[model samples]
Target: MVSNQNSKNLYQALWSSADILRSKMDANEYKNYLLGIVFYKYLSDRMLVFAVDLLEESASDLEEAQVIFTKAMDDGEVKDDLLYALKDEFSYLIEPSLTFTALVHDVYRGKFQLEDLAQGFRNIEQSNELFENLFEDVDLYSKKLGATPQKQNQTIANVMKELADLDLAHQGDILGDAYEYLISQFASESGKKAGEFYTPQPISELMTRIAIDGKEDQKGFSVYDPTMGSGSLLLNVRRFSNEKGFINYFGQELNTSTFNLARMNMILHGVDSANQHLRNGDTLDGDWPTEEPTNFDAVLMNPPYSAKWSGEKGFLDDPRFSMYGVLAPKSKADFAFLLHGYYHLKESGVMAIILPHGVLFRGNSEGKIREILLRNGAIDTVIGLPANIFFSTSIPTTVIILKKNRPNQDVLFIDASNGFTKGKNQNVLEPNHIEAIIDTYQKRVSIEKYAHLATFDEIKENDFNLNIPRYVDTFEEEEPIHLGELAQEIAATNDSLAQAEKELATLFGELVSTSPEIEKELAQFRQLLHGGGLE
Candidate 1:
C-alpha cells in the first residue's frame, strides 16, 4: 500500500517531468513521452526489486540491487540462469545495461544516447505479447521533441533526471492512480481532444457504481467498455467490486494510440494480462470478442457523442442492431454504439451509457430504437447529468441505464442536471451529488422534482420520446408578485427619492462657488433638480 504523503510526492514528481517537455511540445503530444518514460521506469524499477527479492540478499535499495544484478550478469555461469529466472518471474527480461538505473547513471556520466532509450522500449515490446508495441505512441525520433538528435536526447535526459527519484517499486499500488492523475491533467490541457481518451473520474465512478450494483460480491464478475478510453472506466469496476483481482476486463478502442494507452493503464493498475481482453478496432465496424462468454455482467461506455458511422443496410441483419429492425443514423451513431454494448450484456447484467440528450428526443431511426427499447423494458433509467462536467463538450449529457430480461416497463428518470458544484472550467458532481443520484436510482422511488418513475403507459402517451423532462418536472416556479404591495413599495421609493432631491437642492442653494463657471453650472444643476428632470 502507498501512503498519502508518498502518493502526493510521487504525483508532484511525475507531473514535474511535464515541464521539461512543455517547451518541446503541447500536452497532447508530450503526454506520450512523459507517460512512456514513467511506465518504462516502473518496469525497470520493478524488475530490479523483484530480482533483489529473488536473490534473498540484503540489498539496501535499487542501486545496490542493480550493481548486484550487473555483477551476476557479468559472470557467464550465472548470467543465463539469472536471465531464465527473471523471464519466469516477469514474463520479460531487461538487460543489466538497459535498466532505468543504468540509464540514469549514463545520464550523470553524460554518455546517454537517444537510441539507448529507444532500444529499451523496443526490448520490452518484443519480449512478450502483453507488452508488444505498448510504447508505440512514444516516438523518440519525432521532430516534436527537438529539431536535432542531441537536443531530443538532452530533453529526454532532463525529464528522466527529474523523475529518476520516483520510488515506483514501493508505490506500485498507487502508481496506477498517479498515472491517471497525470492523464487527467493532460486532458485538462488537451481540451476537446481529451474526450478521445479520457472520461471524467466522477462520471466513470457513477457509471461503474450503477452497473456494478447488486453484483459486488459475485466472483469472477466481468465488465466491458466498448470505448475503453485509457481503460479508466473499465478499471472502475475493480474499485466497487468485492472480487477485485477476479474481475475480467474486456474492452475495445478505435484509436491505436488510445488502444496502447489503455494497455499501459491496465498494466500499471496491476490487472492480470490473462484477464485483459482488449482489442484495437472499430466497435461499430465489426463485432469483436465473438468467442465464448462474449456477453459481460456489467457494460459501461462513454463513447464519442453523435459520431458518424457507416450505418450500412447490412447492419440490420447484424445481431447487435438487428433486433431493433433499423440501424442508427450515420450522422449520429449514439444508438449504434449503445446497442453494441447492450448486445454484449448478460441476461442478468446491467449497463449504463453516457450520450448526448438528443438520443432521447431524436426522431426516425433513433426514436424507433428508443420506442422498442422502452416497450421491452430494456431502458431502465434515464439520468440527466449536469452540463460542462466533461472536458470534451459543454452540452449536458444523460446516462441511460439498461437491463436485460427486466420485468417492469417503467423507467426511472432523474434530472440531476441542476445538482452540481460550479467549477472554474467545468461543472463537477461532488461525492454527495453522486450519492444522491445513486440513491434515487437504487430506491427507484419518485422524488418531487429530482426523480420520477414513469410507467409504460406514460411513455406511450409521450410518443415514446424517453426524454427526461417528459417524466420528471424540474421546472421551478417563481414566487408570485402582489400588485398592491408592489405599488406601495414603488410609491414609498418615489417619496424617498423626492425627499433626497429636496435635500440636495437645499445643499445646492447654499453652495458659494468662487469661479463664475462653477456658479453657473451649480445654478443649472439646481434648476434641473427642482424641476424633477433628474428622475
Candidate 2:
C-alpha cells in the first residue's frame, strides 16, 4: 500500500536534487534533466535488483554476488543470455559502464564524464521500440546547463551524487511518486503551460473514483484517458481497484516531453511496458483505438478548455462527430473532445470529463451537441468544481459524467463550487468534499442546497441548458427583519439623544456666568446645536 511517508521521501529527494539545478535554469528547462536522471537511476536500480536476485542462488550476499555477476558479464555467451532475458522482460538493458551506480561511483572518484551519461541514454533507447526517443528532451550538452562542456559535466555530476543517496527500490511507489512530485513542482512553476500536461492530484482522484465507481472487482478491467497528461490521472484509476495488476492502461499525450513523462510514470509504478499503450499526437485530429471495435470500461480526462480546432466540413462524415450533424464550433472544442471520448465508451462504461462552464450554455453547434447528449441520456451528472483549483487558470470548471445505455433521462447536478478548502495559491477539494460528491453521485440522492436530481422535462423547460444553478438552488437566504421592532428601537434612540442635548445646554449655562468672551462663544455653539445658523 502507498503511504504519506513514502510520498514525503520522494518529494524531499527530488527537491534536494532540484536545488542543485535551480540556479542554472528555470523549472521548465531543468525538469527534463532532473526527471531524466531519476528515470535512469530507476531503470539502473531495477537492473541491479534483478541481477542481485539471480546471483543470490550461488553467492551469500549482494556484495559477493556483484563480484560473480561482473565476472559473468565479461564472458560473451553469458552476457548475451542475460541481455536477451532482461530485454525481453523490461524491454531495455543497462550496461555495467553506464548504469546509475557506476556513474555515481565515477562521480565520487572525480572521473565522471557527461558523454558516458549521454551514451547510456542512447543505449537504453536503442535497445527496444518502447524506449525510442525517450531521452530526446534531456539534452546533456545544452547551453542551459553551462556555456562550456567542462562546466556542464560538473553540474550534471552534482545532480548524480545527490540522487545516488535516495533508496528508490524499497518504498512502494517511491520512484513513481517522485516523478509525479517533480512534474507537479515543475507544472506549478510553468504557469499556463501546466494545463497542457498536468492535472492537480485532488481532481485526478475524484475523477478516477467516479469513473471506477462500481467496477472494483471485475477481472481484466481497462481504463483510458484520451488526454493522458503525464498519466497521473490514468494511473489513479488503479488505486480504486482491488486487483491492481488486472488493470490495463491506455493514454495519448500531445506533448512529446509529457508523453515520455507518462511512460516513465507507468514503468516506475510497476506497470509492465506491455500493459501501457501511449501515443503522442493530436487527440482530435485522428482516430485512435483502431484495433477492431475497441471501447473502454472507464474513461477519464481533463482536456484543454475551449481550444481551437479545424472543424472542417470533412469531419461531418467522421463517426465520432457525424451523428451530431453540426460539428463543435472551431472556436471551442470542448464538446469535440467530449464526443471523441463518448464515441469510445462501452455500453456499460462511465466517462468523466472536466470542462469550462461555457460548455453548459453555449449556443449554436455546442448547444445542438448538448441537446443530443441530454436527449440520449449520455450525460449522467454535472458537477461544478471550485474556482482556481487548477494551477493554469482560475475559471470555475465543471465535471460532466456520462454513461451509455441508460434507461432514464434524469441528470444529477452537484454544486461543488462552494465545497473546497481555501489555499494560498489555489483552492483545494478536501477529502470530505470529494467523498460528498461520490456519495451523492452513487446514491443519486439530492442534498439540500448542494445537489438536485432533474428530470428530462425540467432540463427541456430551461431550453436544454444544463447549468447547475438552474437546477440546484445554491442561493443563500438572508435572515428576515421585523420593521415594527426596528422602528421602536429608532424612537428610543431619538428620546435618549434629546435628553443628552438638554443636559449639555445646562452645563454650558454654568460656563457663561464665568467669562463674557467664553459665554459669547458658548452661545454660538448652543445655537448651532439647536439647529440655528452659526452666523
What digit string (tens of lDDT, one per residue) describes model 2 on residues 434-473? 9999999989988888999999999999999988999898
In TM-score terms, candidate 2 sits at 0.88
Q: What TM-score does prediction 1 earn?
A: 0.94
Worst 10 residues of 1 by lDDT: 526-535
CA lDDT of each prediction against the hidden true structure: 0.90, 0.85
* Best-performing candidate as measured by TM-score: 1
- The per-prediction CA RMSD against the true structure, in angstroms, equals 2.4, 5.5
TM-score of each: 0.94, 0.88
